[model samples]
Target: MTLTDVLDDWPLWGISKQPISANQISILEGGLTNRCYQLSLESGEYIIRISAANTAELGIDRNVEKTIHQLVSSLNFTSAIRYCDDENRYLIRDYIEGEVLSDNVEDMSHNTLSYMVEQLKALHQVPVEIDLPVVNISEKAEAYWQMLATQQPNNEILKMKPLMQVAMSEPPAGDFCLCHLDPVLANWLYTAEGLQLLDWEYAGLAHPLWDLAALFQGIKHSFQQLEKKSKKNSHSEIEQNLENKILTLYGVSDLVAWRRACMQMEYLSSLWYQAQAKKDSY
Candidate 1:
């Protein structure tokens, strides 16, 4: 179906009368697997997210997202789901009125960071009854490497396989928790109420540090800022500042476990870049 057809059929949106005012439909950029539009309506604005090509290949499930949005909306850590398709694919959510933390980090004060951390902690605190897919870091790293292997071999890319071997050799000690597997800066909204996290396509039950590591990996900060901002209660100074903050927020005591999780995420992300490069080259 066409994008408009999909929108009109959305059960949650209740869109009728052919979208009378559509001039304000602006594309919100910056994601490889989804094209999001800020769709302004006569009643209110809604965020319409359409999964891009091969989303299934990347392990996305819209049903899972619907379940998660329902679960977390109960905890008040995220925006409520307005509508979704039968496949848990296309979703329309209440347009969270705030700036993405990435768009205005300088505007975010210390209070903002505390609020963001609390929201993450709330997500981690959710009970584990839901049988979400486990995002096994080591296995994901392997898939990433296999994707990379299809590309022009770089020494750094080749090193990932060895890294995966080492990472998988030992198991982390803690049981997995509810994790927002992709906690990049853009996914978080800093509003007056605090930080409201968005997008659950990558949500899963996984190691807690994985989210923090992913967030820290994407934040554009220098080493000096990293040192000054690192939390004192974190397991080690080696963990990135954001990861350290997350660990501190969650009261994590095992520094080694966090390190291993971060390593796995780093390997997985590198592999993704390599795979994308190979695809572009062809």
Candidate 2:
């Protein structure tokens, strides 16, 4: 179905609707599992997100996502959901006017870092009334591996299975709290109001450290991209400096956090690639 067809039946939540023209709708990038677009109207700008098919295979529960959006919007940490359609798997939200953060650590100022840490701490403290799924990295990875094997056996995935097992054997110690499983830089926006986190589809109850680890992995991935483009070893140094800064900000020792981050990074990357392969096969 076309976007217009979807919007024709959208519950606008009392907002006045204008003639939505092609010029007024622009596709937004960065989402891997959803189609995002910015819709401009005489009333205001908004974001319409359409979930991709078969996302359930990746452990995304749209019902859980709706609950998360409501909770975070109430806390003013995310954009307010103007309307949601559970059956259609689409939602309209107030468009946040701000700069979407870059993954580069150098681009992140000390103030931004502090703000990020504060927001994350607050997110972890929110009271969750509904029972959210726990993110078990090892089990998730193994599940993905098995799924991928059915399509076409991957030797690399098989080899990584043993390592994933070893990594999970000595799991990090931390309280299970609400976490944004995918906090990569693109999901963060710095606005006049404050720092707002977008895309809560992957949000769930897990080790608070997992959030930190996801952030670290995101920064490291950004540096890796830079290293590939510039062929400079300086990117590695910058990544290490950022890691040290993160460790200091969180008051965690380098040993425990880094190890946990590495393990989570591996599991996340493996699952991500397998998911991509699965999607492509479909």
Candidate 3:
């Protein structure tokens, strides 16, 4: 269905028959499994997210997402939700005015990293009253691998099995807390108010270190990309500094254990994207 059709049936924050002009709506980029659009009106700017098909197969529950959004909004960590349709899987929230951080970790300043760490600490402290599931990286990776095998049936993909098995052998040592499983650079917005996190599709109770590991993995990946393009190991200093700060903030002194956890999480992330790609192709 078109945006117009969806909006027409939208409860619209209690405004009946709200007229939305075509020019007022602009599509937003980078939503891998959903359609995001920025809707401008005299009322204010808002974001409307339409869920993708078969997202349930990936373990995303719209109801849980809505609950998590509401809880996070109450903590002032996320944008305000104006309306949500559980049945249709459409969500409307106030648009955040800020710059989405670049995927390159070298672009992140010390101040930005500090702010992100602070926000993460606060998020991890949030009490878990909601029935959020604890994220099991090994299980998720295995499930994705199975799905991909059915879809593509390739050797390269099968190669991940042994690696995943090894990663699962040694579990990360950390307490379970509310964690944003996917905190990629795009999901963070830097604003005048502070750093705001967006997208909670994978939010749940998981190892507190999982989020920190994800951040480190992002920086490492960005550094590798830079090296590939420049034929030099650039951005190593910045990446190391950021990693040190994150480790200090999270109180993780065991570098080897930390790196192992990050590697496991990164592997799970790889499997997830591969599965998503296969699903999209079908």
Q: Top TM-score: which candidate number? A: 3
**Cα lDDT tens digits for candidate 1, 166-247:** 7564546687789887777778877778678887777888777777667667663433344466744332343345555666
After best superposition, candidate 2 residue 170: deviation in angstroms? 6.2
lDDT of 2 by residue, 156-235 (tens): 65666676677675557766888887788888998898889999987888877778778878867877877788887776
For candidate 3, write residues 46-69 as lDDT tens digits. 898888875766767777778888
Q: Model 3 compared with the native: what TM-score? A: 0.89
| Window of ten residues with lowest summed lDDT in model 1 | 231-240
lDDT comparison, 1 vs 3, better candidate: 3
Taking the candidates one at a time, how many backbone clashes does each contain? 2, 0, 0
**Could you list the CA RMSD of all candidates, in the order they appear?**
5.2, 2.6, 2.5
Off by over 4 Å in 2: 11-13, 103-105, 159-170
Tell me each candidate's TM-score.
0.79, 0.88, 0.89
Cα deviation at 49, candidate 1, in Å, is: 0.6
Off by over 4 Å in 1: 8-12, 149-166, 169-171, 220-247, 278-282
